[model samples]
Target chain A: MKVPNILKKTVPVAVGLVVLGYLTLYFVINQTPQWIPENLTRLARQADLLENPEAKRCFECHKEIYAAWKKSRHAIAWVSETYIEDSENRSKEKCLPCHIPRQVKNGEKPQPRLDHRDDGIYCVPCHVIDGKMHGPYDLFSPPHPTQKNLQYRESKFCGSCHEKTFEEWKIAGVEDTCQSCHMARTESRLVQKPVLSWLHSKKQVGDHSFPHGEITQEDLAVTGEISGKEFIVTLLNQKIPHRVPTADNGDPRLYLYVRFLDDSGQEVDRFKEILAPQQDTALLYGKEARFQYPLTAPVRKVEISLQYKPAWSKDKSEWRQLSYPVTGDSG
Target chain B: MRTSLINSLLFTLMLFLIPLQLQAKDMVVKAPPESLGKYYPPESKEPKWIQQMHKMSGNLGGVFVNLREKDWDNLDKNADQFVESYKEASEMVPEWEEYFDLKAAKEFAAAAKTHDGEKIGKAVGAVGKTCGKCHADNSISVWTRFHWPSFHKIKITDPIEEKELDFGKYMGLLSGTFKGVTVNFKEGQYDRSQKALRAFKSRFMELKSTCSKCHTTDDVKLFYVGENVAQAFDGLQKELTAEKPNPGNFWKNVGILGKQGCKNCHLTHRSYAMIQERWEEK
Candidate 1:
C-alpha cells in the first residue's frame, strides 16, 4: 500500500509541533500574571503581600474555581470564629495542620493578615499534596493526577479540624462527616471543584454556578398545633443535626414552653420541657412535640415558644429570657 | 523392545498416580453443616422489651411514623415538625432499644420503595434514632453484630460530620494491615491482580465497616462491599489454610483485630476521599 504524501512527509513534524505548542501554552498559563477577580480573591494585597500567597496565586489561574472555593468553609476555615475558638487561639498544632498547614509546611513564613487573623485553616493545606494520583475520592485507586494524590477529597481531610464533631458523631453512632450535612446536597458536601464530573453533568441541566447561599426560613417549614390542653410544636431537622441550635459542647438543646392565656391575656397555666437528650428531636422534622397544661378557667389561646437555653437569673430578683415567640396552630 | 516400551509407559503412569494417591490420603475434609452451627449462630432473634413503656413507645412510634410521612413532602416545612419527630422518638424509644433493629429494617425497606427524598430523609432520620436506640442498649455487641455491617451498607442521603478519636496508635495498627495487604499485592507475594480484584470485590464488605454502618441493604447498595468481600473469602480461606504461608496467621489475626477495633471500619476522615475511593466504580 502506498502512503499518502501528506502522511508520509509531514505527519511526524505536525504531531511534534502540536505537542510543543501544548507545552508552551501550559507553561505560559502557569507563569503569566493572572487577572484575578474580586469574588475569587478575597485578599486585597494591602500594599505588603504577606498573608495567604498561595491562595492569591490560585485565584490568578483558576478564577472560576477560586470564586467557588473563596465561598467555601475551606477558604474561610481560618477566619471562622467557631474554628478560631475551637482552635483555642491557634496554639494547638492539630488546629494549624488542618487550618493552615501548607503555609508552615512550605516554609512560607505567614505574617498575620490585617483586620482579620489568618490563623485559621485555608484551602491549599488539604488540596496540595505530592503522591501517586488517585481521584480526589478514591483512596485505593492508583495512578493519581500528575500534580498530587487526591486523598484530600475524602471526608478524613475535614476530620482534622472537625475532630470533636466527628468523634461525637461516632459516639452517637452517626457515620457522616462535615460535608455530608453542610453542603446543599443531602449526601455529599457538593464541593465545587472545576474538574468535578457531576458539576459537568449538572451544567448540562442548570447553571454552572456552584450552589453557595445561606439557607433561610424559605428553605424551611415551621408549624405548631394544639390538642386538648397540650400544645404540640413541630420543627423539621431539615438541614442540621437532629437537635436545633447547633451547639458544639454542652447540651445543645431547645426548650419547648407552652402558656395558656385567657381573653384578657393573663398567664393561666404554663408547662415547659427541655427537649433534652433521648427526646425525639425529629418532631421538629415532622412529628409533634407535645407540652401539657392543666384545663383551667377556660383557656382562650395557646402560646408555644422555643428557647435556646433556660432563663438566666444572674440576681435573685431579676431574670433575662432569650426565648423567641413561635407561631402556633390556632384553636 | 515392545515389552520395554510398555513397561516404561506403565512406570510413568504409576509416577503420576502416586502423588494423586498421596494427596487424596492427606486431604482433610470439612465437617458437615451441622457442626458449623456451633461456630456461627442464625442472625435472627426477638429482643426483650419494657412492657408498659414498650406499649407506649409502640403507640407513639405508630403515631409519629404516620405524621412524619404526611409532612415528608415538605421537608423544609415546619421546624416544629422536625422538633416533634425527634421528641417522640427520642423520649419513647430508649425503653425499647433492643426491639428497634427489625422494626428499623421493616421501616427502611418501606421507605426505600418511596421515590421521594424528603420522605426518605424523614425515614432515614427515623432510622438514625433507631440506631441511637440500639447503640444505647448494647454499644459493643450492637455495633459488632448489626451496626458495623449495616452501616457499611448505608447510603447516607446527606453529608454529615464525624467525630475524631485520640487513638492514633490504634488507627496506625489498623492502617498497617491495609498497607501490608497493599504491599503484598505490589510485591506479588500473593497474586497481585487477584488480590486487587478481591479487594475490589470485597470493597462493599470493607465499606460495611465504613459509611454503610448505618444503612440497610434496601436503602442503598452500601454493603455491596459485603457481596464483593464474600467472593474473595473463599480464595482467602483456601490461602489461610494453605501450608507454609508467608503471613502465617495474618487472616485469623486480622479477623480478630477487626472484631476488637471499630475504628478500622468506622474511620473518621476529614473529607469524602476515602469513601469515594471505596465506593466509586472503575
Candidate 2:
C-alpha cells in the first residue's frame, strides 16, 4: 500500500502537538508559582515584627477564612481568661511559645511571637515563613506571594504547639490527620476576593474555628443500672481521637451527679464524682468511665446526669448535659 | 477527508485534557503522614488491696445472688465468706472501720443465722452499703490505677492567706495526731485521748480535700485512711459515754488504727518520686 506524503507528515505533527500540550498542562498544574509580589517583599521587611495587621491584610482577600479564624481558640490564645489562669497569671514562660508562636518549626519547638503576643496563634505564624505566604495550593495571587507547603497539609504543623496531642494522635494510629477531624472543610468557595472568584477555581476551604469542644451528647454513650443498691453509670468516650475532655493547658472535667429520690420524688441523698486531667480522671480514647454509687437510703428512683465542663469555666453552671436516662429502679 | 482527520485529532486531545482538569482540581500537595503506631495504654497490674477487695466484692455479690435464688445454704455460705472477708479486710486495714461499718458484717452474720430470705437480703444490702461506701471513694480499679502514679504529694497554696501548705506536712500532722491518741490512751487519760482523736479526725478531713488537687479524680481511695481515723474517734466517744471507762477497747482500736490505718497507705504509696516520674511520662 502506498502511503500519501501529506498523511505521514500530518500524523507525526499532530501526535507531537498532543504530547507537548499534555506536558505543558501537567507542569503548570503541578508546579509551584515562582512569582513573588513586590508588595510582599516590602511586607516581608517587617515580617520579623509581624503583627495582627498582617493577618488583617490576609483578610482583605481571604474574608471567610479570617472570619472563621477570628472566632477560633487560636484567635484568643494569649488573651483568654482560662489560658491566663492556667498559665498562673501568664507567669508560665514555657506555655507562651505555643500560644503566641512567631515561627512554626518542623520537629522543633515554635518560637514565641515578640510583637503580636495578643493575637495568639494568628495567620502569619503558620502561613508566612521566610517572607513567603505558604498554603496547600500553588494558585495565582496578584496582591501577595504564595507557595505550597506540604507541612500545612500534615499534622506536624499542629504538633509544634500540640506536642502531647500530636504524640497521642501518632499513638492513636488513626489514618486521619488533625485537619481531617478538626479542620474538615465545610464549603467549596473561591480562595480569593469576589472579583477574582472567576479567575480561581472553587475549592473546599477548611473550617478555621478548629473546634475541639463541639462534642454533642451523641458523641458520648452512657448507660446506667442498679445492681444491689449500687448505681453504676458507664460513659464511653466515642468518636474522638484524644481522650474525652482532653487539653494541653487546661483542666477540663466530666462531673457525674447521682440524685436518689424517695417514692414521692423527694431528694434522699446525692453522690458526685469528677473526672479531670493528670490525676488520671480522663477516659482514654475508646475507654469507659464507670462510676459506682451506693444508695444510702431506700430510694424509689435514681437520677444520674453527666455534665462536661470545658477548661475555661469556673464552675459547671453551663454544663453540656449528656442525654441519658441514668434513672434506675422506679417505684 | 481533511475535516474528518482534524475532528479525530481534536477528539483525542479532549480526552487527555479532561483528565488533566480533573487531576488539577482534586490534586492535594500530599497525603497526611502515616500514623506512628497504635496507642496501647499501659497494662494494669491489680494492687494487693484491690485484689483482696475484688474477692470480697465477689463474695458479697454471691450472697445477694443466692438470696434472690432462695438458696439458703449457699446464702449462708456466701454470707459467712463475705463476713470473713470483711474481717480479714478490717484486719488488713483496721483504720477503715470508721468509714466501713464493721456492724454491717455482724448484721449479715446474724441474718444468715436466721436463714430467712427477706432478712438475709436486707443484711446483704446493708453489707453492700458498707462495701459501696469504701468502693465509692476508692473506685479507681486496678486497671485505671495503672494510668496514675502510685503516690501523689500535692502542695496547696492559699493566695488570699498568702500561706503555702506542703501535703507532706499535713501527712506528718496526721501521723502525729494518731501517735497522740495512742500515747494518751496508753496513759489511761481518756479525756486527752478523746481530744487527740478529735484532732486526728479534723486533720484527716482537711487532708481528704487536698488529695483532689494532684489527683485527676476526687474519687481517690486513701486505702481506708479516712475510715480508720473515724473509727478511732468513735471508739474514743464510746469510752467517754460509758459509765466506767474501758481502756482495753480504746487501746485495741488505737493499735489497729496506727498499725493498719496509717502504715498500710504509707507502705502501698511509698514510691512517690518514682510514681511521679512514671505519671509525667504519660
Candidate 3:
C-alpha cells in the first residue's frame, strides 16, 4: 500500500476549487435577476401555493388524462342539476359524501372533501393524499413526493363509491375488476412534461376516462320468429356482465320497441316494453328476455329495436338506440 | 419390565402420529369442485346433484324406519337401495368419491342383520359419520352457491316519486323516511311529520309490489310482504293520530317491520346472497 503524494495534494486542491465554484454559482443563481424561459414546464416553476391543486393544475402535465377525466361523469358530480336536486341542494348530508369525496382507500367509503367542494371526484381525491402523490407505479418525480399504492389497480379502490356495482361485480364471481373493464390500460408516458418525462420509459398507464365500455347492438342480440298469429321476439343480453340500464339511485331504462307493418307496408301497431334494474324487468347478464306480441292485423313485417337511457340522461334524444332489420314479411 | 417396554412403544407411536395430525389439520378449506356445477342448473336440464343427495337420504331414512319396525323384508330392500344410491352417488362426482365409504355401508348392513341394538347403532353411526365428514366441509359451500336466488340484482320502485332505485339507495330512503317521522315529530314540525308519515306509508305499501318480482307463489308473498305488514303500517298511521297514543306504538310497528320484514327475510336471504358473492369454486 504505497501512497502517491502527488495525487493527495492535487485531489484536495481540485475538490476545494469545485466546492468554491459551486458556492459561487448557487449564490449567483439565487440572488441575481434570472430570465427563465416562459415556455419552461411547471417543473421549473413550482411556485403554486395551494396545498391541494385542482384537476386543471394537473392539465399542465397530464393533458390527455386531464381531458378524459374532465369529460367523465365524475367531473360533473358536484355541479350536475340532478345531483343538486336529489341532494336537496346539498342539504342532505348522506348524498353529499360521495359527490365531493376525499381520498379513496381500499374497501372504505371516502369521507367528504373539506376544502374542495366544487371539484367532485377529481384528481386530488383519487391520486393525491397525505401530502404526496400516489399511483400504481414506483417512479421518480422531482416536483412532488411519490408513493406506490397497489390499491389503485384494484376494484375495491372504486368500491369506495360505486359500492353496489362493486358488490354485483363480486357476486359475478369473475376475476376481471372494475378497473380492468373501465380504466383499460395503454402504454405511454404518464407525464407530458418536457425533460422530466424523458427520464422515464413508456409503461402501462390506465385510461382515466372511466369509460363504461359502451354497449351496442353487438351486446344485445334480437332474434324472432312468427308462429301463426303470434310474433315472439327474444332480446338476449349476451355480452354485458351486469344488468342493462343499471344504476344506484337513478332510474335508467331499456325500451324494447316493436313496430308491426301491414301487408301494404303501412304501420299497423307499435309496442314498447320498458325494463329497469331492481324491478326484474331489466335484461340480465347472459340471459334472454322474451316478448310475445299478437299479430291482430293482416300482418306483414316486424321491426324490433332496443333503446337505452342512462340514469343521468334527461332528453329522449340522448337515449341510445340499437336496431335490427326486419327482413321477413308475414304477407 | 414388560409394562415399561409397552409404554415406551406407545410414546414412540404417539410421537410419530402428531405431525401427521397437524399436517391434516392445516389443510386449507377450499370450495367444492367446479365439476359439481355439471349436474346443476344452466349446465344440466335437471339438478342431478340435488336429486342424488335426495335419493341417498330417502333410502337411508327407509332403512332406519324399516329396521325399527323389525320388517326384515323391507329392511333388506331399503338396505339394498341405500347401497345402490351410495354407489351411484360415488360415481356421480369424481371429486366426492373419496368421501363415499362403501366398506362402512357393508358393515352397517351386516350389523343390521344381526338384530342387536348396540351393533346396529354403531354401524349406522359409522355410515352417518361418512356423510357428516363430507357435509361438514361442503354443505355450506354448496348451499350458498346453489340454493339462494340473487335478490340484490333487482331494483325497488320508490312509490312517492314513482322512480326506481337501487337496492342500497331504496333501503336508505326507507330508513330516512322512518327516521324523519321521529325527527320531525321531535322538532314540533307536525306538518313535516305528517308528510314523512305519508311518504313512509306509501313506501311501506309500495314494498309489497316488489315481492311479486321474486315470489310468484301467493303464499310466499303473503308470508312477509302480505296483509299483516300492510296492517302494521296502517295501524301506525292511526296510532299517530290517536288522542293518547302509546309511545311504544311506533316501535311496536318498527319491531314488526324489523322482525318479519327485515330480520326474518335477511335470515332467509341475505347471508347466502352475500356469501355467494364471496365464495369461489376454486
The estimated TM-scores of all candidates read 0.30, 0.49, 0.46
Candidate ordering by TM-score (highest first)? 2, 3, 1
lDDT (Cα, tens digit) per residue for candidate 1, span B144-190? 33222222222211001112222333244335545556467446566
RMSD of each: 32.2, 30.7, 23.7
Better of 2 and 3 by lDDT: 3
Question: DockQ rank, highest first?
Answer: 2, 3, 1
Query: Which pairs of residues have clashing backbones in candidate 3?
Result: A278-B154, A278-B155, A279-B155
Error of 2 at B106 (Å): 86
Best by TM-score: 2
Q: Kindly report which residue pairs in candidate 2 clash with one another.
A: A279-B215, A279-B216, B95-B228, B99-B227
Displacement of the residue B60 alpha carbon in candidate 3, Å: 67
The digit string of per-residue lDDT tens for model 2 on A101-202 reads 888866568877667677888888887777667877776555455677778768877888777568767766778888987888766553556544544556
Where does model 3 exceed 4 Å of error? A1-51, A278-280, A317-331, B1-282
Write candidate 3's Cα lDDT for A182-203 as tens digits: 8999998888887555445667
lDDT of 3: 0.68
Q: Tell me the deviation in Å of residue A35 in model 2.
A: 10
DockQ values for all predictions?
0.01, 0.01, 0.01
Find the 10 residues in a row with the least total lDDT in model 3 chain A. Answer: A29-38
